[model samples]
Target: MEDEHEAIDRLSTRIDEKLSSFSTVSLPMCFKVPNLLRQTNEKAYEPQIISIGPYHHGKDHLKGMEAHKIFYLNRLLQRRGETGVRKYVMALKVKEEKIRECYAEPLDHNIDGDALVEMMLLDGCFIIEIIREYQTWNLGELQERNGNFRNFNVESVVCDLLLVENQLPFFVLSELFHMTPEPNQENDEHEATDHLSIWIDHEKLSSFSTVSSSGCSIFRVPNLLRQTNEKAYEPHIISIGPYHHGKDHLKGMEVHKMHYLKRLLQRRGETSAHRYLMALKDEEKKIRECYAEPLNPKFDGDALAKMMILDGCFIIELIRENQTETQKIDVDFRNFNRFSLKRDLLLVENQLPFFVLTKLFQMTGGPNQENVQGFIPLALLFFSRVMPGYGNGLVIRDQNIKNLLGLVLDSWVPSLKARDNYRKISKEYGGWNFKYSATELHEAGIKFKKIDHEKIVIKPEIDEAGNEVIKMGNEKSFFDIKFENDVLWIPTIKMYAYTDSILRNFIVHEQCHNNDTRYVTDYVTFMDCLINTSKDVELLRHSGIIVNNGLGDDEVVATVFNKLCDSIVFSKKSFYSEIFIKVKGYREKKWNLWMANLKHNYFNTPWALISVLAAVSLLILAAVQTIYSHLSYYKR
Candidate 1:
């Protein structure tokens, strides 16, 4: 009838007293309950004795006592309120204060849950309650109270703390803890982390997965912090070795220590083993949440990235296994978040060994080479996530790469073949680029013509307002625009057309200059160069926003256009028309001067130079002809 804590503490003290009789069982306090060894046959507590190994205990009786003690302690903590009843929780709060002092700076969000759990595991119920209350108190409606959001970290800390205790079965707790908040801010943006729920060893993952694992996957890390420090390990590998009997054995599997870790610290000016331990303690207390978890099923891409940074090999292995397993299950890629994986691909693509990358590229489905190539945007963002300034290991910008993708998709694939795919893709409601929409005819003295043997042609029609209209057929259709050197690449009607109009207009206006001399296709090199230039502009814009919000005129124009585009895409036809009108007005105002200059400059210098050279040659020939004529007259 008494609480579990009261009963366990009494039993524990009796065991501790008895354990003292054996010298081999030194450090009895290091374990939870000292009584596990009191009896040879521990059938009563046998269910709890998943593992029993001696660190210093050599005597058989002492070893048995150590196991018994740990068994009781593990049981005590497993039930939430047991430790609190024993008054150990009060001491835990004091210990937590000591733990806090270990870190130089206020702990970042990463360490909150882990720290709380570690403190709880060491201290007991009162301390756990205090931490929980502290978190809860911090969560009041007031701005000040809301400022330090501690409650969110509590579950994770508790979960992780329990995990590092390494008392629970691996897959059991692994499945028990893998959950996250919504990954992306909005549904439209394909965010990677939107609440990860991981499945491992065929077990269901739980919420607050952060507390349930010892290390996080690299993908779960924020883009900015993944590279700031290097002391952290990527907990990527999980040994599924000879003793694959149960979760306990698997959970306690040793993480292969980095051989260079000591050397790294020493080189970084850590003088002694004590100093190294101090730094590690600080990292564990402040950066790690009492404990951390390895990448698991519920880990969002950001967590996955973090795990990768800690241990790229482990995350990649899991990814390979998961992808294979998921494929076997025929799971849709759309169902689970894919963005979390983007960072991993980027991290391992360059940092890991070549064999790893080769193996990753070898994964079935999607042309390995093309998938690797088209996934540059995903890669660039990922490296930026792991290490922001870590360039894509190449000079290419995202836009340039996109253009390059366009060219590759174009030059390598014939238009006829692409058109076929494009036509087929147009019919679907959501697959690929197909979206269901009603088409209307435009009228401006033009007609919509369906060439029997050719692609659909736009012939204009005069609407009631005498405006131009183009009518699409009764069937829903989408144009299959390959990433080729065509209108598809020009930011027109597909992809991000309206938002990128300024950019598109710039490309076209620049192309007009080249077009005066040669056909548009003939001057592909010129288009390529402009595409590169525009990409630089976009990068500069993004960089400006990142460093300092610079509300320049161009930025204003771009933002307004983006807003208008968003409205058009999300709003009804009436709203789209109004937005389109504003867009046209803005486009006209923005490009009037640039367009005029483009026209004036188009045929001016190059054409003038050619004309002058021709004139000079003609003059020289005329003079020679006159001289010959005069010489002939003199001879006559």
Candidate 2:
């Protein structure tokens, strides 16, 4: 009997311990910027203007925004008339515990339940009011409260509100929002009561929900490269997603976003905004899950919905205006260069969910009110300006392209089946072991030729052994190379100032988001092998395979490629394994080696060719004279 009692006690204790462990393991939506990534570029991860969530909540510099929060909260209450603040506080009280659970870290003991509720109330009201003000442009009341509010930079505030560390749970804001008065339905009890029950249902629904692993396509830049080149991942002129929300340096671009936003409203009509907002609200939960991190506490369904609508509209409009020559001719393109905007849009951190863009484009009736082809085509057109052949021969519909950078990478990389074949080839042919430079290959009689990108096609074939094979067909692409007649025919690749940034981000994307194919990394590795010095760069340049726009000197280009190669962790399998084997086989041939030496010695230039022919003629005459002298001696 004692043994049975002890066993029961032990089982109970184990159950209690497991429950305790589960309670402590909260789902973290937002994470404290990793120490390694932060150490490299502290500015990229740190909030500059205002703090949104608990992480940077009580910082001294960010306290200035506290006054604005209170002001917005007062405005919200005033719009509600009597007992508004009390009702908001009461609603948030019920959500205080739920809100605390959303963050990965535990709340400080000093910030009791009351303090937490009040923070939620104030921050929630501020975000809702700010978004409302942006939509309505009603600065009259704000000016009356404080003249400086009229001059406040909306861009900086909008950016700050979206940071990962600066977010509030959507439920808390949704709860508080129910207490606020609704326009045109002030007397409708059902409208106000409807939201209260909806919030509860959302709470219950969210608790039981599990985000699928494949759902989140967005990813932070890999820590390895982020530590070394944060600027490469960061947006210089504009903030897109929650990651690099509000920096002072990026304020100039905020005005442009605003201009684009206003233009969008003017062009699409104000009703279009409402339609897009509704569409985003419907997909808010899925959109939030798409982000790798949980949104900041400030982003309730309403606030996030508003942001998606505005940002999506701005992007769609920007693409539309840029494409129409009449619009382009009227606007001063010099101030807002398409190339600069393209760079900003392609940054890994600066991206919206492609779905949001697609939804907005569809809601706006698309170009000509037809199917939603405008978004992808316009996006491709924009990127192709910066990266030649980016959209050429690409079926955008065939890809699960997540963002601008993803689209750019999809255009350049081979298909999944092709990548698998390449991996198999690499494994079968002694792995990715080739490391000869361009100059070395040239010396080994491997002549270099430029392939025309227009005529190339990538075709899949079945080998004699019944194995499926894929080859870089006649399809000419940026990195396509073919070996024929002891020559390596490589397509021309243009290297500009922004090439490093584009390549690095694409590599980082592959490192973080993609697991199967490392096409960009493999391409970089192959380039590194081919380019060891300025002579290699010169050789490629002479072959018309490299179009150096603003990459400075050949030494600089060599250093760039070398450093890029050093940073990435290359896979054992490579996309160019078959080509490497062919080059190696050609180099091993004695006849080819002899022909290379003979060419280098005697046929390097026109003058050298003429001198070699003269020498051969003299040798023939001397041999004939010697033969005649021998014959005369024999006769005597």
Candidate 3:
């Protein structure tokens, strides 16, 4: 029994050592920030000097926080000389006033003060004040072991001071010093006696950048200020949208607006235009930079971009890749003078399909410059979506829109309309009428028409003994697949038809009886790459054919799928090994179908047809022989 207890102790010690090692490697940088700040303070502490926060929580918590070691805080404060210490003192004073204001009570000032101090401690502001007060006072008496308090601000202090500060006080008081120190602990402390302090001097905090006075500092939204050096309401960055506009639209534009606009575009030759993207921290500086001529026609490239935004969805846009060279550069402004708004501005309504189309356009390239003016809104929407700090997800929820999108993607790629001798052809395809509109279908409650199979017939019932006493013969074959009540019931296949592509693939590729479905994903992806990319699908002809061994129960799911393939085809050994290691589960299944088609297709090999013909001929010969033998027997 003694040995068992000893072994348990040994095991616990090993576990604790392992846990400490793991924490060092796995903890993130954020976990070290608070500690770093504490260390900065520790380096500034003098051996006899002690600092405390005006706030209760700060004093109470930091009184023994692992980061509160005197040597570290003092070291940090030393670098800034006395200036850093003074600044910390001022900040702490400000925090103290804030704490007092929060805990103000009219009656029984002592109770109010006590409650307020404890409240501040609970709020974390108290700790900040304590650290500030401790640093400013440099009270050496507070550093003594079993240090006695000179004064009590509230009820009896529920804390004890220790000469050493290496870990959070809670842990030390509760675990290490809850009772008299063990013999080993006493020996360890005797050999180690060091005092130090450190401080990290940061630049003065600005009012706008400091944590909000309202305790809700973490969640407050940032306020963007306009720059006085530049013009108000005019951003330093200008993004021209994909929508086209005539050059005449640019004629009456405000000259002042143009100046700011040009500056924003950086066409004036300075790289400062990009500064608009900076956060609110440098809003004023960014504006001043824009004053240096932002945009110039000569150097500034045409701002052609398509942008879209939803009330809730993030903004989306399409910026043209580059200017394409055409033989004739036509500059026609005769009928292009209208100031039309971007399609996205009209609101969602029944506009899902059109919205999707605009998104695709934005994904492609920006509009041509014949319509650069009168496109600021579109440009703004586009930039809002593609801008570095913005996040948006485009989703088409309307059924009509989804169907129309499917058709459009299936039919033709989006492109610009070109003038021809014949009347101009609308670049838009699919969703030509309200029938294909997303709103129209949704209002009508249209749904996909599912094809139904013939009803299944019931079979004769059998008893548990397997004895058919009653003569029941008529029955229907239970081999047809059925989709009933939103459930895919495949009686023949004995598998559910999962609508989700991934789930279905998992079921097929991983869960199927033969693992026959597993290879489909790979095959599909391969086929798509081959066929869509102009590569000949026939190239797969050399690949081994995947034949489903009719034995469903004996089929391999995936582990042996490749082995079976090699068994039948006998391909290169290295190719087999490479495939097994590279592909785990596949995303494409069409490639498998493509491979099967390639192997079976008569176009690839005339020999297949020849083989079929030979088999038919042999069957015919056997029939003739059988008929001849029967006739001879009858004559005998």
Candidate 4:
């Protein structure tokens, strides 16, 4: 007991010592130079004396000015009438997370938050002093203290301050700037901000620009996306659109595509494909523009019209065959690997516009049958089997359906609320986060629970006298994640062979598609960040968050998620940001960390728990023996 108490005392003293050293340089608040600055002043923007923000920070040539920044900071503190560094640091420290988020890249975690906040304080004050003294070179204190301020080329420093790399966040500087009093200097500060805002707002405005549908929503998969799992994007049994229209490896499915198209004409009681051909020619330009990339130059208007008509008719007929057994085509879609075709249809590169398929369906269908249901619901009916949630009431009206991948995504998101929560980009640049794998979080006292995949159903019913009734079943979305009371409730994900491919393509679509809604990407990225290795995979598997359905070992599942995010850009502010902040708060409590260590190191293992019990029994026996000896001595 004496040894343990002494060790704790030493630790407490060490922590106090570290806290006293908080006023030092640390993390950078930086982003790339905005293109607006590059275009107008490309040749003229380099930091002459020192870097202000994170962009040009840590350059070898700029190290000499570090002493000068401190030199200016010291003078500013005296002028502001501040006694110590604690108050300024405390002020900025309260906003440390928000301050770090104002930059584009994620900051390194090596520096403690207190130290980073201290750096901001130093930089903010340094800017005010250097700029103030640059114009009025007769700083009475500086003239007396040192010759360094006199040696500085004030004009060069002023020009350097205007560069985008030299730009500090306005709010950060403003917080420190207003702490001190200066006669008529508010006008000068406002003027300087006005100039910076002209460049700052230019970039901000572009990021928040209104999202609109560019008729060309379908994109050719970039090589960066294909690196994860190449076969997933490539159609094994068939090709659908212009991007994969004529690859030799996919030629076997060509005969099957034509057979289905011929069967469709037979069902329509038409001997000629002339009407479909003419219809396709009329809409060739529209169809051509629907693909984001240009078609093969060899495919002029006639070739494109033929390909569009054939591909469009093939998909309509294929879905028709899948949707109904009664309206059967003579060719056997059942004998082939139907799963391969379904997987191929979900690929981002292999897609036809919903309109093209709709047009072909309307032309080929009997008016009575076609009028019964719109193309959107019919399409959803087929894809719902693969994705599993669109048949529910949450799907919006489908006039806006872009393609197959979009339809599949609509099915994945369970509710309008989940969609809105993900799409809500914060106006404040404040969603920077830390990645904590499943094992790491488990050791930090977070409990993981698998959300029941049952649909929570409620109904108002008259039962004998009259009462309301509620019901539920096993059917919920994988994206409905909840975190509360240090318990994370996530829906179980079933991993199949096609799971990796489909997820990668979905991520790519979200990256390139319109409306800035990357709900699918965000969810996958969150899961990837949690599963760092097979150990994390095993922890999550035991908790029922990940279910491997014959997808090799746990390591394979872990590798799938870890590599899924390669070369993919993630939004700085995302759906899980608040959850991350809450989890950090929970883990930061010292009691939680100590308790977690105790529970994991002792109670979780049988031999360790037994050893702990033995040690505790010895301590209790020693105390009782000492008490008896004292009582006997007193009685005597």
TM-score of 1: 0.18
Model 4: ten consecutive residues of lowest lDDT:
204-213
lDDT of 3 by residue, 1-636 (tens): 999999999999999999987665423211112455658775332112222222222332233231222223333333323322333333233444333332222223443433333222222322333444465553332221111121121111212222222112232223212222222322211211111101122321122122212111001000011111112111112212211122344333223224433432353255442332222223322222221112233322212111111110111212221112221232221233211112112211111223333333333223442221212223333222211111111111222222121221111111111112012421221111111111112122222122222332112233567632221121211211122332222111111111112112111212111111122233222222222211121112112112122222212222122221210111111111222222211212355335434444632358887877788899999999999999999999
The stretch of ten residues in a row with the least summed lDDT in candidate 3 is 217-226
lDDT by residue for model 1 (1-636), tens: 578989999999989888875544322222332354537544332212112221112332222122223332343334432221122322333445444443333444544543343323323322233344455563222212321111122222233234222232222222212211113232222222211111210121122233333221111221112222211112222322111112353243223212223333344465443432333333332223321222234444343323323232333333443434543553333343333232213321112322222223333224432343323332222222222111111122223221221221112121343334434543312111211100100101111121111222223344577643332211211111122211112211111212132222222222212111111121122122222232322432332311212234444433433332110011011211222232234334534435534434443368865776798899999999999999999999
What value of lDDT does candidate 2 attain over all alpha carbons? Answer: 0.66
How many clashes (backbone N, Cα, C below 3 Å) per candidate?
Answer: 83, 14, 81, 2
lDDT (C-alpha, whole model) for all candidates: 0.28, 0.66, 0.25, 0.66
On the 0 to 100 scale, the lDDT of residue 603 in model 2 is 80
Sort order, TM-score high to low: 4, 2, 3, 1
Model 2 TM-score, 2 decimals: 0.58
Global Cα RMSD, each model:
30.6, 19.7, 28.3, 20.8
Per-residue lDDT over 1-636 for candidate 4, one digit per residue giving the tens place of the 0 to 100 score = 999999999999999888776534344445566688778977467775566766666675555455556555555645654324554555676787777767666655554575466457657777877656646653333332334433233444556778766777788888887765464332222232332233323432222221112356787665445545677678877788888878897887778777877888788788888888888888876777687665789888788877777788887776776667543444556556665677888899899887777778888887643631345445555555454222222433346668877876765654556556555733322433556778878888899998765443322233354432211121346677778898988887878777787788888777665334456767778888788889899999999888787677899999988888775656545666666677777876898778767877887679989999999999999999999999999999
TM-score: the better of candidates 3 and 4: 4
